[model samples]
Target chain A: MHRDGRAFAHKSSSQQELPMSRAYNFAAGPAALPEPVLRQVQAELLEWDGVRASVAEISHRSPEFMRVATEAEADLRRLLSIPGDYAVLFLSGGATTQQALVALNFAAPGQVADYVVSGHWGKVAIKQAKDYVRANVAASGEAGGFRDIPQAAEWKLSKDAAYVHMTANETIHGVEFRPEWGALPETGDVPLVADFSSSIASEPLDVSRYGVVYAGAQKNLGPVGVTVVIVRRDLLERAGQPRADIFNYASHANAGSMLNTPPSFNWYLAGLVFKWMLAEGGVEEFARRSAEKARLLYAAIDGSDGFYRNEVAPGVRSRMNVPFFLRDDALTAAFLAGAKDAGLLALKGHRVLGGIRASLYNAMPVDGVRALADFMQDFRKRHG
Target chain B: MHRDGRAFAHKSSSQQELPMSRAYNFAAGPAALPEPVLRQVQAELLEWDGVRASVAEISHRSPEFMRVATEAEADLRRLLSIPGDYAVLFLSGGATTQQALVALNFAAPGQVADYVVSGHWGKVAIKQAKDYVRANVAASGEAGGFRDIPQAAEWKLSKDAAYVHMTANETIHGVEFRPEWGALPETGDVPLVADFSSSIASEPLDVSRYGVVYAGAQKNLGPVGVTVVIVRRDLLERAGQPRADIFNYASHANAGSMLNTPPSFNWYLAGLVFKWMLAEGGVEEFARRSAEKARLLYAAIDGSDGFYRNEVAPGVRSRMNVPFFLRDDALTAAFLAGAKDAGLLALKGHRVLGGIRASLYNAMPVDGVRALADFMQDFRKRHG
Candidate 1:
């Protein structure tokens, strides 16, 4: 029923043209989606899967929607290469809620949980978990304005820590733990939990290395309302603390994440995205495009000869979010307005870091980034 | 861009025909929405409000989206005639999650909370709150199989109860605290909290009467992901319990429900619903339609000489959900299959109470109920 098959025919190429009124959106989270996925959703807005009703209007427990839910988890499992030992949960409340849940589900009441802070999201993770656990900031980059990840030797991990938490990538601060930043420290028996909200599925991930990988499905994933939590099955056995049955991960996992009515429309949209990602050759292909996109954009900023500046250290620059500032900060408003006029939307920086931030998510075509790079050069030539 | 304005023009008239392939869907919650709203969504799936992107693809914090959020709250306030002393919150996670949060936000740790159990959802509220509060079952209809709400005098409220909790309507048991049932008890200084998930806007509501009124948007509202919570402003001062900041209601209220990334797309859809409700004459119009729809279906059931049966007591019978049984239980499969062929869908019963159920929320047109009534009579004539 989709009317636009031609748009997705060449999925990986940087040459595809955007549809009319569809701009190169650079918003972080609640970000852009693949045109083909949006087309499919529009096509089936009235009748879905021969059910004679919209997917959003059907019962989540209906056999028709249960099939949708099952296929989504299966496709996500295949896309991420998640291990069989890991149970995938499609939940609501975004990553912040999951931040609190990780502590309530895995840590004993008032037990110490070590946190390796790298940026704004890392601090948020600690803020959410502190009430449930004795949150210990094992390491922090805040001292340097979160420009880089602290050296692993600087971390003062607790001997009796319940788990070591980290933000895999920070959306606002544009900081990430790249391979060059050094491998995450081995916590021995203590499991490592990472918030991969902005970075999951942007590259191939080693699922077996961590105890829990949770993300709000808004950035590299499809939508904003649903969250995906990949937990090692054994972690479900932890009787961490007294919480409601609705707050229990094991209970949700046992019920196939249908302990209550889920965000079915968001989950279904994520499923469409999963199918698109698989069709575009999964995380491995995304990694290649991501590297290419990041290299091009970083090269443009670095070649500007101080016309533009990105404060993040080169070693840990986020491939997903590239936050940069013009040499004259007063010109920020003109740059954003000019970009919007050029059909580049949501280029304004987040309130936490007020400059220009372009988020290159999986749905962002390589062409979109190229357009942004071209726009940056054009703006620099005009203002320099 | 909407192709069919004709469909919605005669919205309240039973003579209006269903659109092609559109069935009379009766599934509870994640239920059928107004066709006009779906048409608008489909028309704007690619570009929304000149933003050059789908509403789903924009940042919730952006001014474009902030306007949508604010208008939604304002329209809802106008529709419900909510007082200035109330605070409205648009949150993720459904009614079940709020059931847990109510205790964590309003009651002291291990403090007594009174519960009036009318149906399955009431029992669920207690289950979610038992860990955080001293749950006192002040009254229960379980002894009578939840066929009716107990008399107001039968309630045994605690002297120092934090709040009195009740489900405004029972979706599964086909029971409700209808006006004919009786006025609610006066709790002196204690506030009354109600779960209005299945019946919120179906009639004119006295918002000032309840301390907190919460409903998942899936049923009578709009979609499945977002929830609307209205609380008396005075209740925000309670210490409640030590919980994560994300779980705190006061924090969400103070942040304008944008404390983190909200379910923006769902909230926008709900905003569309609010506008439609206002345009179609608000809660007063819905109340008239609900009474008419409920009358037609119940008359068909009662008119049948034992062929169709609804066990809910007439005084407390829900105008929203009508559950019934066929005289010959073995014909259940044939009845459901026949209904599906006749374009009357989701007639299958909830697993909790195994029998056919038809939910007539605000969006379910009176004509759809008339179709179900006619189909029931035709089936009885052929099967009997």
Candidate 2:
């Protein structure tokens, strides 16, 4: 780090030559970027190939920035094997927008939207969309307190529903679907939309499984400014029929996502993360690492004699976030405080779900998991 | 200026004491930010205190980032004299959304709205709103080739209009209205709405004057991801029905702009720019510099007899952007090419408005004008 012409590095490179400065981040979204991606952004921050400005500070309408915009969408398309029938669009606002947007663009006024209330995220989605269109709980797991995914057979499919919406993984509840994509309830061609925010880029996803897919770029992907949406091309054209343009993904896609000024810096960072994901053995390696990280953390929880326990079903345990509680709830705060003193942070659970949560996203290397697991064990010993 | 333990300044900065490294940037939006603000962001890119991360890389939900969001809104309100009756919203999409959003939020289904189409920006606004509701041009300067604002006498106000909309400044067409709280256009008791994208923050306005005012944070404020909207509190709960909640000012305001993961980095950058503006003599000083810079550039054009020209009506000329043309049309490319070689970039005009444009926004120092005028004189001596 350089400040006022002074360079500072905490220490020399490791004995095995591993980079010592990488953060073992466990943030939920904009969570953790690959170490190499951050370095790439730093290198290109001041000047990009003869252009005398940072990519973030440049005009989005400029030719150079345009290259980045298109290349990012292209790379994302290649990574996800996005079908030709789909129009991949980059948007601003998080999944919260999609809750309202999916309803506005897809459903006619007063049409019911079938929502699967799996966890906290789904509840918020349904709450927001209720303002736009009628929301029907086709399925819910609140009976089980979001501890399991609703089986497809359990949903009461609506005859007049415009589409069915589900969150593939709930970061708050730490309940994930067994399959990468959620099971489609039989709805007779009623389009399905999935919020893949927490799970985006963690593994290969079948783009053909749904009519629309949207992800906020905070965890696993990149930073906090942009959202990636891949929607069927047919759905894009349908958006402008009676809907306003800005909220209509088709209008944005038609204009190359420049229907308005974009979140240029975040878009550029997302591109860097996508490039990093591509180079780091693609999603296959990410899936392997993500599963491994989840397994180690869960196994440690299960191995404990009720010192730490997670109620979410095994098949549905999230690969990105794992929420657990100490047997004696009084020890939770001390465990978190001790973990932070040992250089671990954001180990707290969701506000609605009070407990300890270690979000092990794609950026969490095996070493980070070991460190977290080590802290968990140490904290348990100190408190138990 | 240290990249790797060594001091390095771009040759442009090192070559002069003028900080010509801060050249005149005129790419419209995502255009030139204040030089000091850009330097400040670059300085803080890697670490922000004990957080050990760029503000952009932080989670939007974190307590540290929430402070950035809340304080930015507070500072903006103080700077704009925002009324207690109004809600200030920080959104992602630019002023373009406000076009449809204003209609969606204020104009209910089956109701009509009025628009004053002054130039390209207003035209874009008009076109976008027409997609959602029955919007008619209350007035227009299309006959004047969008070179001037319509006189107050010409506005044909609608008696049942939900709100009256206007672009306070036309970025491309080089026209601007004097800062008034926000004046009504012939409609009694009806609210006033203005898209002040190009001219906001240049001066203080009476907040009680308008129902809504919006500006994108590319040129005058900061980076390009977020937008600023100041709306009367009553209007938020009333008329306009939105097709999308993300672009809807009410939803964003209701959520404290944290309804979703915000563009945290851009929000932070905008806050820094606001603080910079406030520190550097507030809105009054910004106005003084803007008027001075625009005056210098216009003087050079108005002084050039048959060599150069600007066609906008003198009284309504934009202090932010000055579009001029050379008498000899063929010299345009050589002029721009020479300007860049001399460190003046993005001075090219919009393709539709051929010739040269020197957007002398708040960030542009008077020195950029002297350099450009000098370059213009040299180019004319050879080509005139």
Candidate 3:
């Protein structure tokens, strides 16, 4: 199929051809890009669609870029099955900015915004929300070291809560919510906002279930700079207080995310990614591949006879991020060095969590996971 | 020199090459990028520094991308000769965000932040600021139809102003502050915050003269997403009340702009641009080339004998944005069509202005300006 080696073959012709042994990056994003999308970006970097200038060098207000922006939003909506009532905003400042924007826009003065603290990102969101509204922690997995999602029954729903915020996947801890919308505790009319930064587009999403689904594009999407915010159109009317034009969601939606010149090049690249995702059978294909990849890696860890261990509960394990540790802490440097030498890159966990985290976003090929699993077995045999 | 034709020659080898006749883009911004920089980006788009992943795909936390970020800041500091006491931040959300940050961070409740409303952008800054602080318009050129900068002597200075704000160049109105630091009205110990979005790096700047200097990279710097903010270190101490982590300049500066994963790709590209500027003899060369380009275009307008007219006063004419008009407004469509056919693109003025604006930023080669001049003269001959 053209989807497989054709993309890799095209890349070889470029001045920056891939090395003989291309490393499978597991960097937890800004992470690995699909080979096809990267090739498309390279092919179009100088002159997009017969335009003499690179997409980055053109005005956002120009017809050329506006078309790209429009097409991108269309493709995204099609992929997510977004309803007509949702406004998909291609914005700057990533998911962190969205954390604050959600609070500032939805939470009125003296109102509480419920936050389910599963891991680091949820905690950060709560901290940022505190500056704007009363951030109420309705449920916290921190007491259990964020190894699993807290039970929905344990969630303390706030009657006067403006919205309930949750992180769909915790990258650092490799904890993820099971992809079942019905599992969420009812919050009546209170909107549900999910930070899907790590796991967006990895599976089929029921867009109608959430009030807002926001993601930073560095993970499963595209590069950094561009952030996707899919918000219920009616929610914009509830936007709290007059704020900076850039921070105000209503103004951004009104301007079609062109209130200020958008990150044009990033937006264009994201469009390419969206096109690639559609061509590859969309999110269903990704979900299948992601589940298979995670199963293979987890089996390898389980079979290692205590050589390797992942702390997250099996039921809540992240298909995207697999964080594990070797039995001997002193062997960390050697493990990393050996992994790099074997053409596996960025396998080191985040600094906050000192171990190995192999993030398998949608772009991560199944073969890459196989390679990592094989490496684990070989490493265990030698080191054990 | 390797700087000249090598870049263009390499670009032609790509699948998406420039046409036989390349157009000179005159969009205010996202504007023209240096051809060499674009080529460098294209060549390295898929693999940077022997890494298999595109620069965008790599983790911002990775040593590979961290080096890119560090080198970018270092090159920018070298190019601008930034002082030790200033923290240079590479942030997202553009200069519009800074307008609010400038007010929110610097101004306490009931405190005033004086703004000089020179043109459209200044008016916008005032509007965004009013949400956060007492936005005092110390001076305005609206009465003069934005034909020139308001005289410094006629300015009102506030005794207890948090800061004084101004736009160094207004892209929409083709107005600019005269390049003389001494001409600025004294504000005692109050900080001078300038939105150098359109004019930054056009000339050598004394970083010590202003408390904060911010510019969106889309203009002369690079593509959109990354905004360069050089702020005095002392100002970090008075960062008003706590706000969103991304909105707080102090937090951004402290994290070295890595708070919640920065726009790594844009930062890397901006670094490439900074390096290109340095290789082409830094800001002084840009200033010299900019002057020559603007002179050619302005002279062409003046020589049109009433066919082409610019309303700005001769003394304060902008060297970056040259907005002019056709004597017969009915011929606007024909003028634009002809210009496009002649390889002059994005010449249509801002919708609000309803004329032609030929923005000559640093990347615009002198030859591009000469081509535009020739096209303008030919257009006048046929239309007159």
Of the candidates numbered 2 and 3, which has the greater lDDT value? 3
lDDT per residue (tens digit) for residues A327-350 in model 1: 899999999999998988898898
Candidate 3, A299: how far from true, in Å? 0.8
Off by over 4 Å in 2: A1-23, A180-188, A239-241, B1-22, B131-133, B179-188, B242-248
Q: Name the 10 consecutive residues with the lowest summed lDDT in model 3 chain B.
A: B1-10
The whole-model lDDT of each prediction reads 0.91, 0.77, 0.85
* DockQ value of candidate 2: 0.30
Q: For model 2, what is the error of residue A275's alpha carbon versus the real structure, in angstroms, after optimal superposition?
A: 0.8
Highest TM-score scorer:
1
Give the candidate number with the greatest DockQ: 3
Runs off by more than 4 Å, candidate 3 = A1-21, A179-182, B1-21, B179-182
- Residue-by-residue lDDT tens digits, candidate 3, A60-123: 8888788889989999999889999999999988899899999889888658989999999999
List the TM values for chain B, per candidate.
0.95, 0.91, 0.93
Per-residue lDDT of model 3, residues B180-204, tens digit only: 3237876779999999999899999
What ranking of all candidate models by lDDT puts the best one first? Answer: 1, 3, 2
List runs of model 1 lying over 4 Å from the truth: A1-20, B1-20
Q: Which residue pairs in model 3 clash with each other? A: none
lDDT of 1: 0.91
